[model samples]
Target chain A: MDRKLKEAIASKLMLLATVFSSLLIFAVVIGLIQKSRPILATHSLSELLLSSSWFPLRGEFGFYPFIIGTIWVTVLAMLFSLPLCLLTSIYLAEYAPAKIRAFIKPLIDLLAGIPSVVYGLWGILIVVPLIKDYVAPFFGYSATGYCLLAGGIVLAIMVFPIIIAVSEEVFRAVPHEIREVSLALGATKWQTVKHVALRAALPGVIAAIVLGFSRAFGETMAVMMVVGNVARVPSSVFEPAYPLTALIANNYGEMMSVPLYDSALLLSALILLLVILFFSIAARIVLLRIERRVM
Target chain B: MDRRKIEEDFFKGLMILSTAIIVGILFAIVAVVVLKGAPALSLSMLTQTPKGGYYLGKGGGILNAIIGSLYLAFGATALSLIIALPVAFYLREYASERFANFVRLSLDILWGVPSIVYGAFGFIIMLYFGLRACLLGGIIALTLLILPIMTRAMDEVMRMVAFELREASYGLGSTKLEVVSKVISRQTLPGMLTAVLLAFGRGIGDAASILFTAGYTDYIPHSLFDPVASLPLAVFFQLGTPFPEVQERAYASAVVLLVIILLTSVSSRLLTKRWSRFVIK
Candidate 1:
């Protein structure tokens, strides 16, 4: 091939590749929409979104319980993890020695890289048994080893590393001079961290938490193993309940046997996709604000 | 005691305690997996396939899953590299800032989209083609899952390539493609390799995305059309069984997966350090 022609062809091919990569998001959205159209056409949105009964065999496909379950589990997890993660991030950013920070940071990243399934397995063997043996009894609930509380606890552990990693970055982004100035004003290290660094990093920390929330909400294999895959509105954290991710993960294969079952599963997936997209965009906006401030 | 001193001591103690808890949990997870799975980790488990009633607590191994996971991760990583490299190159070398940012935002959203959604998307694609759960479906799903991670990581590395080098290459009459292949890629090779390894780790460890798309079986796949087992699925299915022995095997499978991930993570860290020695900045 001519040299100029070859370069032109290569440039054109790269552009084509970029265009293809960018279209993946649209492709997923379109695929979900097309696949879920059957359910959308057959069922009312309110019924799908509000009703709690989820009997797919009888053609009842209410996702209300799963939504509630997702919210309940995710909220519980955040409630448990947020304070600890913040404290850990604060320590890593301000309190720990450089060597400690170096060692701990990668340890946290290692925790993050551990497979979700391993977390699920640990949840089954450890968290479930603990709940069944102790925590459930204290709450006057009989634990079957798989319940919302187990799922929430497992999820809390799973998201802890993410929250700590991001929030630590946010805390670190507060210029060193700001800390020095606060310390020079006779404020203790804790006081400076609380009054100055925390305030400045608030937006980024919230973005990190939001990102963690989306991560917990979309997590599947871990939650599926622990959150008793029963589709119902739980009366207590110790009760078996189904979250959206668990629902789709557990049922998509079997749904092919029934009418609109596949659609219902796809609809759940679509809902998850939209929820994640919203949080991701929100996180990016907050991160952009942080970047502007830092720069 | 001074008020500020007391308050500082209390908060510092709390922070230390929290960090302890986090580190403690990491140790606990590894300890429990090793304690339970060590007995079941055998050479035969690494070499043989499942026998009759393996899920029912009979003798067998997870060789099928090990091989299948390798096949899927390798295939998916190769596919993702083919597309992600070009896209990363385009973003760094050609695209407008606005266009690049928009593409990055889209990639971020795709990165956060739940793995289950990918499975569902892959399942839909399979249905449209009247295809069953097979290695190909799994690879396609995993490719999508790793695409953003690999591209963004590569883009970050490529951006770190000194602009002066590119200018110098152009001054020598190098085409844009030549500069990208020879100059930019050479500078970013270590980071790119780390990204690929990271993506491969993710692809191999993920279960939800491949749950239905891969359709787990006990045998090693003979072709792209064949259904394949994976370590995660093996662990998931075995752990779900009522048999105690099978559950032990599940733990063993998890140990295998954990080891693979840790190895990848460690190697990536080493690669970054080693290759970083060659980077100009």
Candidate 2:
């Protein structure tokens, strides 16, 4: 073949691959919806979302408890991680010396690379027992280690790397000139960061938070191991509650045994996917806007 | 002025405390895994498959899971690379900036998707095609799980290749394909290696996506269609058993996984430095 012809063919193939990859997200959504059609046909959307009773054996499949459980864990995780991660990012990006920053960056990256299962193992062995013995007792609750609190704590740690990494990048992206101007105006380092760096990176910081939220929301194994797999809405962090990921992971084995059990689980998966998709898109938009502004 | 100083001092202290906690937790996780799992670590555990009553705290090893995880992750990484490489190259060389950005947004969204959702999606695909839970199914699931990750990592690296290099290649009267193959690929090879290692690490560690797709078996898989055990699921399953020894084995399994990931991250760093020495700044 001529060189031009070869280039044309190669470019065409590349485009095809790009298009194929782009279609996968839609394919996942459609596939899940099709599988969930059976359960959706029997129950109204409201009934699925609002009802708390979850008898899979007899075909009752309300996801209220699981949804509430997921929300509780996600919200609590964000509450735990947000302030801590932001402060750490601020320190790393602005306050820390170059040597210290270099040392810490890899440690955070290593933390991020640790597998979810390992995190789950650590949670089960350490965090669970601590919460069960020390934290819960102080909070006036006698509880199993596997509870919403444990799930939240594990998830918070899991999200810390992403949040700190993104926010630190955002803070660094605030040009040196801006910080210098603030300092030149007689502002202290803390004042400049609070007024200049934080304000300049607000959208990016929100994007980081959204990204962290989506990650924590979808996390399965770590949260599954710690969260008490109870099919009820948790009244407190110490209460055992079943999140959607755990519900799917724990029951996939027996999904085929019961009528519509698999469908219900797929529907729950669909719900999780849709929520994650929304947040990710939102974060992407924010990130893209920031990129454009920087350029 | 005094209040401002106090406020700064207070926030500074808070930042230090937070950093200390995060770093402390990182060390604690490794320490706990090694300390808890070392006693149970034996040569046989790394070399042999589980025995008949392994789940019941009987003697055996997790060689099946170890090998299965390697096969699954390796297969998935190779498959994803085939697609991800083309997409990354096309984004940089052929596509317009706006279109590249749009595709990147899609990839970022996919990257954030939870692994459990991918598992469910994979299960749906399996049911559609009348396939069973096996190594093939697991590989397909894990490829989907890691494709976005690999693509994004490669794309980021490709973006770092200075435009001047591309211009110089084009100035030599080289075709776009030649420029991509001969110049860009060489420049980005190290970064691409890092992406592959990163994806491989993720694919091996992810239990949720493979839990249902890769049905656990005590023996090493003899065929692509055979159900295969994996390290993450091995850890999860062993921990579920009531026997204390089996639970201890779970910690050991985690140690194995931890070591693999640590090696992956460390090697990728060293390799990136070693390979970038020849590239122009």
Give all candidates' CA lDDT scores: 0.91, 0.93
DockQ of 1: 0.79
lDDT of 2 by residue, B101-137 (tens): 8888888888988999999988888888898999999
Which is the leading candidate under TM-score?
2
State the TM-score of candidate 2 restricted to chain B: 0.98
Ten residues in a row with the worst lDDT in model 2 chain B? B101-110
Backbone clashes per model, in order?
Answer: 0, 0
Q: Give me the TM-scores for chain A across all models, comma-separated.
A: 0.94, 0.96
In candidate 2, which residue ranges exceed 4 Å CA deviation? A286-295
Give a tens-digit lDDT track for model 1, residues B118-170. 99999889888998999999999999999998998898888788889999999
Docking class of 1: medium
Per-candidate DockQ vs. reference: 0.79, 0.85
Supply the global lDDT for candidate 1: 0.91
